[model samples]
Target chain A: MNWRGNALKFCDVAGLPALEPFVRLLAGEDVKEQLKGIAKFVVLPVAAVAVFLLLWSAAARTVVTDSMQLPSPTDTWTAGKELFAMHSAQRAEDLKVKQEKTMQAVTLLAQANSVTKQAESATGERKETLLANALVLKKKAVQAANYRPSSAPTFVDQIITSLKTVFVGFAIATLIAVPIGVLCGMSPWCNAALTPFIQIFKPVSPLAWLPLAFLIIVWAYSGTKPGENFFDKAFLISAITVSLCSLWPTLVNTTLGVASVDKDYMNVARVLKLSWSQQLFKIILPASLPLMFAGLRISLGVGWMVLIAADMLAQNPGLGKFVWDEFQNGSSQTYARIAFSVIIIGLIGLLLDRIMIFMRNLVSFGDPQAA
Target chain B: MSVAVLDRPRSKAIARPAPPDPLISMRAVCKGYGSGVTRNEVLSNINLNLRKGEFLAIVGFSGSGKTTLTKLLAGLEIPDSGEIVMDNEIIKGPSQERGIVFQNYSLLPWLTVRGNIALSVDRVFKHWSRGERRDHVEKFIEMVGLSHAVHRRPHELSGGMRQRVSLARTLAMKPNVLLLDEPLSALDALTRSVLQEEILKIWEEERQTCLLITNDVDEAILLADRIVPLNPGPNASLGPAFSVELERPRDKTALNHNETFKGLRNAVTNYLVAVRQKSRDDEALASEAPPIELPELQPRSLRVPRGRAG
Candidate 1:
């Protein structure tokens, strides 16, 4: 029962390159048809946006009083170009700052004279001048350390970082959620004792939790610090926050999935004298995959949003920070850039979801009639 | 030459009483659900024994608690009251010693035909190399004539093909006892008959202790060394056991003309008649037991339309 759809159809729908081999395969088999199914699923938001654009464009085609507030498609495109140019200039500024910082740090490290010696009035004014120069260089290095490229960060770069954070949080949540959920679902007592606590935490918003997380973590790790850099702290906070928010869906779904496993499979598990390992591997996991994936995908999306909000506040170096910085910049171009960023973020999120679905489909592909 | 195939096994059985003990023994068996407040006694005060290499058929109407009994034997559900001893020990849970083939063909929806079979084989024979499990499963798939669907998922498969995978999975396990809980009842007539023969052939080669639960009279008689009937559902008990006196290596094509085969068929048909009458009897008079007092089966007890002449 092969469930494979048309690859060509998927490609055509996705607007991917024809890629001769794929087209041929689709023609040769029903590969293109299956691919089309996948493409249709993924193109929903894109299609919606395209329709919105067409309508917006049709309206914008007229001057509509030629108001500056009414930024037309052409204006948006020009704005996009302007923002890109600004970012390019900003990126150059950032690189210069980084290069200067690196040179200062290297010079300081290689400096033959100690700061204390340089401060001594060995040559009167020359000594003062040397010490002042060192101090200024150190300050510049610190400032440069904070500087990042101003060029509009590519959507792909943001996606990578976004993916990293979401996956990290999701991974942490899965590690905690699946086992706990499976345990809770399998045992009523476990469910009773542990489940309510989860529900309590589940409903608590990431924004609400951020302050508490900040206070708790900074306080907890104030002493005996391990990697207390901004990036590390942001990663930790996002992961913990995500674990709190993302875990519930997976936990709830997994419990339901495990609880509702078909009795027939259970019977077969028994007859085979399946080891605990075997029972879980051959029956329980596969039976639960459909449901587990549902939870995972939900958790991932939630985590992605959570990371964005967390980053905006945390000033974590990612697209969320980009959005926050853009908003703070409060320039006309930055807002449009923000809008563009938002689109990119949504596209990345959509693609991330598709990847998980693709993995699941891989499992169900060979059996067209897989129950 | 054909007779020799059947002869080899019978001679071995006669020469060596084929191990002294019964393969599976039941003593004072009782199984039920709910408690004193809401108790439904499905099977009670039951005692039976199954010996090695015996093809035992359990016949009953739906809700006769035959499914429960099969489940108990398969180690799916624990016997609420009595003991089921396999290899001289009380069977508490499912073991590789027993393998169950479910009626609905419980193959994983995500797995291909080959993948489904290999999953069990791989899980049980964890030490076996991957290649070995693959080859082993593929051979059985070939045996069941499902080679074409080796990579197909469950939904892609026909009902008959899925059943074949179920058969293949259990056979690959090579358990000492094979439990069939109306395994072929869900299939079309043609598929059912063909699978029936496939099952018979597998049993012949493997010589495992087999217990089949079904409502079909012909199926029971055709596949069993002995047929055991359940009297009725919801407090139903085991009825008399009848030995199938048909000749060895029974030919399904030629068996209808044989007098002994006719006798066995007539006897199973009689049991079927009893089941139908019992169903009608249970139904015509509304169950005095309230819905709460009823087992799931008690509520939806199937009254299969058959001649109610006992």
Candidate 2:
């Protein structure tokens, strides 16, 4: 049948008087039912999460791995509780241990060229090393070592620290990336100048920056007069490394987003005699939102991943370091702690992604996807 | 409460005479592209004035620079070498005093119909309380007869509905001037007529100065008080303005019977034909000219590209 005839036929069926009233009555009731259905859809995920936990517990009883080192989920739960208690015992102690180890490693690597130099700097060194008078002097060695524990940071601490790093790095990246993207979108010269650089740097792996981060951080501390908090060096390094690594997605997405804003709206802005700033803020941002948010989401995810890698290498006092420490420690509880940490990491990543998506929906003006 | 409430646009509101100086005045405006060795003018020495509360339609052929002229009036682009003055100020950039509608509804896809309307209001009335923005947007949505679809997003709406939302958004801003860039061209005839009536009712009630860049002469006859014919370019300009002396609240059904309206439309048709001929002449004359030596005539196809449309 031709299109018009088909439309007429469909209308004939759909517009029946008896069906119309019935449909309307049903629809009114259906709306209530629909609300119920939506509530179920929302609740189902939570229920599914519970079911998965139950399954995991079941699997815990029946060992899933041959390695005695690897714990069942139940074992991980017990270990997790203990770790949490230990972390809560004294918050500063763990941080101090980690810091001292890193500092010891740095001090060993820096001034240990000769026994003469070591003796020369004996007064500056911590008292424990200088007290060992019976120690035999050997040829100068430049080796440095960090003491990584056999268990992860407690679940709560892991959650908190990982959350913080992701938040800090993601926030910094967002603050820097969005405006640069907007500038690139609005100005041809900026796009031209920046796109080449963005293309070049965006592909460089986050791991690639590890060497540079360590060098710069070490240099920065030594260059400063004295007595700077050692933790700041690690935090700053990881944050900057994550920020640089995570910057592209937000920037690229924002630029493309602003570029893709509808022409008619820009015309509307023009007709309103809006300032360039006003146009960017009022029109471009609102219009570019879906894409901009997409970029932000990706940037944050990348930041979270990069933070873990950076922490593991830099031995930053976060989930990243905790995970690495657990691996190196090789304790009987290591597997359980690692499992708990893995779950925490997944949850945190999910939570961070959700936060960005929420913001995206809020900013989005016309799209149903925003909902 | 009474004055503000009663200020709703309605029938029997007579249009007040425009202030002595035109609200927007365009004088000796010449715009060209491809400078130096490859220069060609798009609009040349074009002079016009937009009186307050006037519905002015500009009609022309495909390459006649109608959209260019509209963009200039709306402050979207600076002219190559001429000044466009709005009120007494030289147009520096976009402003809140004018609203524009495009042939393709430029409603942000991410926004709901109501949200799109709210965005324009939000920009202009940043100081307005949230409730005020809601109230103003609701009024325009009701005015455009889309109260049922306020929560519907742009992609969800049909083309006509999207255009209605776009109109609702624009009108909600209550600009002194409203520019329509062939807003009805993309719609089917039925939807076009429906929207035409809606837009006419809006103009009659609000009495804002409106400039419509259209190719439809009959539309010009029905809606515009003055219809200007754009002579096509390398160096196009408005030939003359024809005054539509038809009475207020002009009905579309009555348009065919109105001889004066017919005569005016005929004149516009004649002018447009002259424009088409002129463009052909120019294209033929410049056939061997450098390929780059031409004004980039704003692409006339309704679905223009994204971005600045720059």
Candidate 3:
């Protein structure tokens, strides 16, 4: 019984309420109600998706373009499979090439050792020639040992890049927004001063910020050569654009959350004679966490969306660039690959949202209704 | 008989001789909100003294600014005019010297019962070692009989349990003066009486100078050494103070049979009712004004006739 309750709690915490019906049913709750829940939460969504796929397949045959037809469900699945196969094959090939280079280096090192041994026992002119040969062999071995396969990133690698970029951008946005938001919340003067800038910049699109971000990053890194920089220029530019566009939600939410801490709680803090820092850390911040997380979720979602678009525009090596490059290629499989990518992007976005919700629930206190 | 004694003329001042030096004193305190014509005076020209180790209760109606008075004493709010002095120093801001149990059980919902109590103990006794502070918190939590619910958050606890945690939190601070603002008013009657008894037991043990703000006449008669009524507001002020002379280790059931308790309850209740009625009558008299006349008008039809339709 204890475990059953914990299971349900786990479901709630994980933002997976759909699993509750099954858990309840297993726990011997009302069967009829559980059945209804299963129908609503489990079966219906699956059925709806199936119906959608059927409709998509039917529609794909009807629409025809000069270049290619719209991708059917099967076509998209096939394209997704091909992409995954290609990624695995590329990884294997890279691994094989690295192994071959290592073997070549080993062989060259052995030859250099043999040549050095021969040079030690040789007479004057022959000894010099042998020593020279050994030196060349050693140099070649080092070059071979240091060999790397510089192949382009596959679809999976692009996805990983996109994920990394978005997370970095989200982290940057949160770092900048939360403290400023707290200042704005705590001090009316700070709020008033920042209001105009927030209003002006909030509505500016990521596309609009991209060029400005690019220019600033470029100017900042002007001294450093292209490959010598710590971060790639395009990656930094895209991430900055994402942060610029996405920071507003978190900023606004944190300000609201901090400002709207319950008056009663503040009175308690006062009665306790808590210092300003203590009050902020112990009372204000904890109390505002639910709303702050809600804001973070929105900011992350915005950041993810912005990152994709920024990637496409900036030609950053990510999912957005993959889609863009596919479009440019205009092969028979291009439409299908794009459709497959669309699904991946949507799923990733959904996962991000779910994670944020889970985090929000973790900090949410007092009222379940509030969470 | 105590009934005959109760029928005697009542006075506004405490019948008992005043203590030489009070722990806390409010002098001609006035607080209000708004400005000009819209200004609402909640407490005006209020003066009271909390003698050291005395249990004092201020009984009033809901809107009679009992909370404002509590906040003033707690130093959460400074009076608009006049001064509140504690230990011969003018009250500037809230300090750990005076701890308040709010009417709404202002236990931080995010904190567990232990955390709520420890928060105050940790802050107030900053010089104490971690173990000492923890023991102090545990002692108060046990005193309030909430040891079982130590790990429970405020929302997870019942209304009475939450109030108990609030009481434990304030008590854990070991303030020289304790202010309780209708802390049990939100609970059910059964829970209210239970908590009242627990509060009484704790008070008997600790004997801190305590101030209780409540609307319950019987509750005031039961727990407090003296009862002071706050008159109904716009400008609520203190009424007469009634001394509860009933012997302690007071039992609720025995108090029902006790004539002194009965008479004291009746006297306080009658006084509060009379003052409330008088205030209502004054408000009615002040609100009496000449009625204004309005112009009569008819609703005009906006429809066109059939002949005009062409």
Candidate 4:
């Protein structure tokens, strides 16, 4: 028996069949063949990427904007480094201020506690005075304890904020889409009821929904004082816009998936006298998961794309806003920074897609087994 | 035929007088598809009584509603105008009491060989402990000679192996009625015969009230005690039931030389041919009457492999 067979099988199932040659090479199958495989898979892709960079740099020289020239690969790299440095510096400054305030609060709290202990053993007037002094110190400590960094959000901060926003939007979309999708899939009446709306709204872009989302969110949070709630009105507006635009793919995919669950499986479930919920969870859900996850992957991609536009329009503190700010900043580094963000966004999208594929394969029966 | 025949080896039990009551009773069952002008009637007035521990086969040509009949009996489909009673209880919906093995080997693809069987076993024997359930599932898997494939998914298995998994899944449920919906029809001849023998062996051991649906006369003769021929459709009905006087542990190879087997096979085949000719004649006459352009209906004959049965 081949000892490397199990490792090869894992590579096959993990959608990394290209790695099988590497495994075989490591197992000492054939050096020449393994080198060829490595050249084809690994070396070729890297060479292609290098060629692409060369083309990009060449193109960058030819294309010139009104205020600035198109940033080259080197310029983008430099801008990226500067952004990282700025984030690090801001982070350090914030940390130092926060630490100082926390220290002050701790000292004040200690003073207040000592005063209260002394007041416990004192006479009436003196004790009352001491208690009053402790109360003032406690108030001061509370004030000092609320040490929020007042610095402008950095590039890294924008990325985190954008990720958080997209996640919130995607989660909301899932919550709204799945049950409705299931209902539509399972029942003709539900499908008929919802299809018209889905068709009409599915094509609407995030930009179109922005103003409406803003109005509704602003109205909803009209009474909410700023900094009181975690979700600021603008953040809600941007995220809701992302959800509205991104939800369609998941909804449509889920519906298709659920609707296409095998009749044979349904018969099996029925004959087994499985409960309705059991049928849904065990048979229906598992069968439909592959398509549902495919939808989710598409939805996430759409959500990420839509979030930038939403942030730019709504002026929410995310990568989109950062891009808009840089565009308005009109510095020599602005084009470079924008180019770097574009690459970053693309990489993030690719990563998300890979993650989704992994999730989908985990639950799928097989990768569409032919016969 | 009498109660004494039940006790005797290789006795014709189908000729026995209606004993006490059957395990299931289908009364004037009718089923159709579509509506109004487009509506096509499949089974008409299907009245069947399946006795306890009886091996019955329903033989029909393709589209003669044999599958529909099985589906009705399995409680997967409700009849248009009749009732199916099982153990004096009216059949309302599918239940764990009636287990079916479908032609397509309807093993859940996501599940391993053991998992497919375990799904049914767990459902039926909810009271059984986890260890007991696993043991029961493993027992059936081994019985089907699929112990090596216990961890393999359906797609990884061959057609024959997949069918075996489906069989194991149904049998592991230990249902009161075992329904085989042309289960071995999808398999190759060699695998078909092997599985047929395995099925015969399992039926002998379990003695579950079995219903085997097939298009093969030899298959019906090989396994079933009573063979019911379903007439060709538009509105198909049962032709008549023939009893096979075959013994338990019957050998297919030996049966090839047996006069009784020859007679039985010929009788069933002739009956099927007659029905086919009649249906063809009816179709010819109906089309001839209509001058208006109508698409000619292709007659589908029973796809019997020439050398295998004969």
TM-score of each: 0.75, 0.62, 0.93, 0.87
How far residue A63's Cα lies from its native spot in candidate 3, in Å, is 1.7
TM-score of chain A of each: 0.67, 0.67, 0.93, 0.92
Rank by TM-score, descending? 3, 4, 1, 2
lDDT head-to-head 2 vs 3, winner: 3
Calculate the i-RMS of every candidate, to one decimal place: 2.7, 3.5, 1.1, 1.2
lDDT rank, highest first? 3, 4, 2, 1
lDDT of 1: 0.74
User: Which of the CAPRI classes, incorrect, acceptable, medium or high, describes model 1?
Assistant: acceptable
What is the Cα-based lDDT of residue B55 in candidate 2? 85
**How would you encode candidate 3's per-residue C-alpha lDDT over A1-371 as one tens digit per residue?**
99998898778877787899999999999999999999998899999999999899989999987767999999999999999999999999999999999999999999999999998999999999999999999999999999978999999999999998998899999999999999999988999999999999999999999999999998999888888977898898888988998899999999999999999999988877788999999999999998899999999999999988999999899999999999999899999999999999999999999889888888886443222
Enumerate clash totals for all models, in the order shown: 25, 16, 0, 0
Q: Which DockQ value does candidate 3 get?
A: 0.69
- Across residues A172-267, which tens digit of lDDT does each residue of candidate 1 receive? 999999998888867789898987798788888899988877887677677756654544776677667767788888999899888888887777
Top candidate (DockQ): 3
Docking quality (DockQ) for each candidate: 0.43, 0.33, 0.69, 0.55
Greater TM-score among 2 and 4 belongs to 4
Candidate 3 steric clashes: 0
Pairs with backbone N, CA or C atoms under 3 Å apart (clashes), candidate 4: none
Docking class of 4: medium
